[model samples]
Target: MTVPGYRNVPAQEWDPAAPADPAEAEEFLRLCYTEVSRLGPVEPRLAVVRAQIAATGTYVHTTDELVWGARVAWRNASRCIGRLYWRSLTVLDRRRVHTADEIFRLLVRHLQVAGGGSAIRPVISIFAPARPGRPYARVWNEQLIRYAGYRTEEGVVGDPRYVPFTDAMRAMGWPGRGGPFDVLPIVVEVPGESPRLFELPEKAVVEVPIAHPELGWFERLGLRWHAVPAISNMRLRIGGVDYPLAPFNGWYMGTEIGARNLADPDRYNLLPVVAHGLGLDTSHEATLWRDRALVELNRAVLWSFHRAGMKISDHHTESERFLAHMRNEEKAGRPVPADWTWIVPPMSGGATPVFHRYYHEADQRPNFYLDSEAAALARGAGVRPALAAAPLAA
Candidate 1:
């Protein structure tokens, strides 16, 4: 099946029934072993992988190989600006997990492991890889922690992006609280069984109440956001193998919450509210009232997260770290493939150093990918009949 590309990246069509490409496997093994000197030699591992693929169409990754593959995938993520900490990622191998109940329990554990303390760490839980011509399991939520959006007579009560998903959840028997910041349930679907909804415990979700450092009235708005940004739907590809149920997370970049999630018209749309609170003249767009409100909203997000002792990075700091990552990779004689559009921060593009330069754009392997089917599922589009009958591969 054809897996659509993310943004400007080219699409990669993968056939689930097709055998793993021997060349891709060899290249990945060679690279992995060569880079990690302690891994010893690749020849023995290569022979074993070749024989395994010849016998079963795919090869399993050893624990060390799986961990290194996940770390390399983060390093190859073209859109991520926090690649500097790729090596520090915590990879949780959950390949033995299959049932929805077990998956849900582990998912909650994943959240607790990643965001349990004040400092959030990068974590990825890799489940069983898809066998050739077999249906795989996956989570339907775009992120592990997202607020539900209900369409009301007034307007969208929560995040508008999730209204359709919320509707789908309700259809599947989820009794939502109908509040502005109600955390959505985790939808886990196993191979043959129907999708199941598991609500996250209050202890599993770490939230920060947004309040501006200067504006005393800002806390009255009751705006808040989850501390960890755990993306649950993306497929993880490594060494010609696909793991459909791998969910990974990193700490928040302030602009992600401030400039896009909160400021976007379709999202919380909080700029106007903040502007009105600031008493800025909204008479004309030229007055830069929106810009001023956006800055304050971002400030409130950063300050609130900091006050809550939550790990978060400002766009400026992240941009600088990305450049440092590029330099480190270059010194190691490796090309840093990056998408310019995603590398630049959402707000204050010109002010950031990443906006001024060009980056090499390439579809690198051993990277996380968002398949079209997975994206649709995250949007609450229940499994299509055609896709269910003939499942797509990552």
Candidate 2:
């Protein structure tokens, strides 16, 4: 008898009513016996597999009960995939191993006993190394050891392999492997309304201000204002899941030196911007940090597109505000600052806490805001245009 669910006839799809002819079943049984015969099976082990199944009752059913049964058929294949990756590692010791194909066969045997195929893809895609370290079984040994025992932060930062990094990297949906160590971007997406906090001391209402006239859409909704440190990175909650969306690296706006040197800062000034800064998966985080220091309200700067006045590519499909800035600047011909240098440190622990170490000030290339010089000159002095009245470009 063949082990139940381990091997089945290949069909376009599974059908419970399908009954294969007895002759075909007999031929399938002969095939299974012939397969086990090659593995050092002399006359004595002519058909070790079928006899083993006969004695073990492993072949009692034709189809599985629920999803697990439907999945058992693919278990052997899953382990092969796992071994395929494991054997590909160039860093592992190659002297002790057999052929890569044989190693895969043994690996498959060990994994197939459970819901093999169904479990492998998620594990591999989520955990398999984007880069292999070695070419031997040691790779599997290390992985199993760490997985069996949690040792990542125990000072055993483990082999900087692609699995762990990619796991964190997967959160950003940027599966892009090793192009360049570029700046990290974090994108948060909220639907209908901004995500909220679960427990506030005394359940106080939190108000996030809409500083830019361009973002009055936030106030038109129901967002409130709250004062926070300016040197911090963005830490927000979206879809009921708490997300720590900080700049992989942080910069400040002003410092003691000259107020434009790049200083590494921590996550600060955590607040959601208007609909503009939501739903991005890059490692970069953009927060709204008001620039003014007031008891109730103040001016803020969005650190991500801190170049709020500069012009991005006009060729982009989603490039609306960016292109508008360019168009307005070209009309003025003054050429806003094309460069930026974050300066100044965020004040620390006081009525206002900003870390001065990370302050930066970059030169502006072509600043174009209605509130900016162009905006001031276009509409006239101190006359703010209705930001809510403007529509995002088509």
Candidate 3:
């Protein structure tokens, strides 16, 4: 397939019947950002990468496995195509590998000079544990410094919600720390039809108060469409169940969404992102962006892996366990309502945290973080604007 902006790289073919590569197994990382860059400086090298990447089920083991090759491709392609027009230093002057976050820094710079609206979205997936921002972040980040055009030590930017330099962002931007990549937020639709269903599919997930007056009900659920339970004629209802689950049709990003996901919490927080603000007609020019969603989806898939490299992260909420306690409150019929607190899974107990560190090599050099978008935004943009329209808490 011709990926317009980029030359083709070797893509791997998959055998569904065969076992998956151990690296790509269990966890999946999306290297969406580096796809265009993977083509090499030479036409032939670009072809090799194009062929390798074209495969359907290529597995990503480390962040290196995911992005280095792609960055190398871009470095190689620089000889002829957009090189002369570029206003910055050449990547060949610097020889190093880059991490997803670093790539993002460069991507912002690329946009600053290239002036493309949103062609450069990248995602990464990490299958293990690693620190979010330490010196090592440089290892994967070095490659970025080479290709990214401008320079100014500006703290990680590209605020899709608010253009940092824009007077609008400075004058009326929320949280007011303009990012160059700001795009108006879009609001997706939430139907008023019957939403709660039972026997959710394997992908079905829910989030609820850890300490609610009415216990037993979970908070939120993020599952794949395939995971939804087979609804029967009887299962349908207006609302109100012990679990009080809400159905959503969207993404449960594994690890490919990358720095875009990180900048998110820094941008407007995570909840709003999950709500799909890209669709709000009054907010964003989403339709104009609709055509390339596949490319966006591809970026999302790849960026997820980069985000995963930060460190093992999770929602870490005490709300659910407290929900059971809250149930006891109502059972005793206590008039006083319980206050909320940050939820942390008890490590001593049998509870195994989703964000534990992963020792990638024999040296025990910790790499990757098991982060989820739900945790980053803390409650899908919180229980504010989207809540009133959203179903009331059970």
Candidate 4:
């Protein structure tokens, strides 16, 4: 699981049923309790935590610990350059939520709270952790907000990137309206039950209609995007406890929507279309048609979000804030692990300060990671029996 240029980075185990490493688990619990004590009066709770660990090989976190763990996880998220405001994240402690229907309802509430009229706030709704014997609840969506992709006689309809998910949804008896902007229903998998799809109500979603400040023609494109990107599938490992249903969010970075989602060839791939609309000579790459179109597209995204009164950060300001974060971490004697490929802005990579530097390749604990099992389920694969077993709490 080592990425290129990163030395000594080990891939995290993704299997939910894999036995926990006792030594590593013990170290993680020690760090958790130490952090909790530093944040508040947890001396009494420490005894309970230790006893729980002794009996179960894992410990329960107080509400304060959960909040701290979630926030620190964000700070330790090497792939996210937007961690400058990690302290601002809001944690919705939903660890008590168990059923798929309740999970869907809370997800709706998460969208409502985070998407708060484009004043977009960072939030994470943490569900139950996988105990030693019990399988925890899991959501199958990459993000809470995504459009349905449909297969058609003409070609792929809507977003091509979602075809697999869309096909999977169809197999689950979800027949969408088959439109370009159809919102996909969320699929929640509970232990010992069939995975179910829950449709998102229109009132819960906030989308910004994209338009350029000056380019009237851009409005004709009818492009739009959801306000918040609440990643739902990444497993949150805190103090040896794995919460498979923790969905967290942050305000959008303009490049995420403009330079990648709308511009990547496998996605909407609007660069060529936008170039033609702008009358740019697409005859050759030498003309820099793609580059020129990208700028305007990014401009539209920024302008649209601003006009809609939504929270979005331009790459320049975010990069500067990231450097400030790095300095603060260094001053505190904390090592900052970053993935250069992700730390650098998607557009104008070399032009940004982050692009010129090398980052520590080591990964930190209490971080978000992709789970292969969750990914396979999201792709509509048949449920693996092992994944359905309830996690056994020691």
Winning candidate number (TM-score)? 1
- From the highest TM-score down, the ranking of the candidates is 1, 4, 3, 2
TM-score of each model, in listed order: 0.95, 0.15, 0.17, 0.91
Give the range of the ten consecutive residues with the poorest summed lDDT in model 4: 385-394
Report the Cα lDDT for candidate 2.
0.22
lDDT of 3 by residue, 15-110 (tens): 223322323221112222233445323344334343443453222223333333323222222111111111222221111324333322333333
CA lDDT of every candidate: 0.90, 0.22, 0.23, 0.83
Lowest lDDT 10-residue stretch of candidate 2? 123-132
Per-residue accuracy of model 2 over 1-394 as CA lDDT, tens digit each: 1222122312122121222223332433343335344434333332442453445422221111111211211121210111112112111111222333333332222223211321212211000111112211111111111101112443221122223322332332333323211111111111222111111121121112233344444334332222111111111111111111111111112221111111112111123222234332333433223221211111222311122331111111112332344345457462322211211122322222121122112222111111122122111131223311222110
Best by lDDT: 1
Query: On lDDT, who's better, 2 or 4?
Result: 4
Q: What tens digits encode model 4's per-residue C-alpha lDDT throughout 107-131?
A: 9999999997758999999998887
- The per-candidate count of clashes, in order, stands at 0, 72, 89, 13
Residue range 1-394, candidate 1, lDDT tens digits: 1223545444665667777889989989999999999999889999999999999999999999999999999999988999999999999999998898899899999999999999899999999998899999999999999999999999999999999998887777777889999999888889887677788988899999999999999999999999999999988889889998899999999999999999999999999999999999999999999999999999999999999999999999999999999999999999987877788999999999999987777677899888888888899897444333321111
Off by over 4 Å in 3: 1-104, 110-371, 378-394
lDDT of 1 at 258: 98
**Ordering by lDDT:** 1, 4, 3, 2
Off by over 4 Å in 4: 1-10, 18-47, 382-394
Estimate candidate 3's RMSD in Å: 26.1
What TM-score does model 4 achieve against the real structure? 0.91
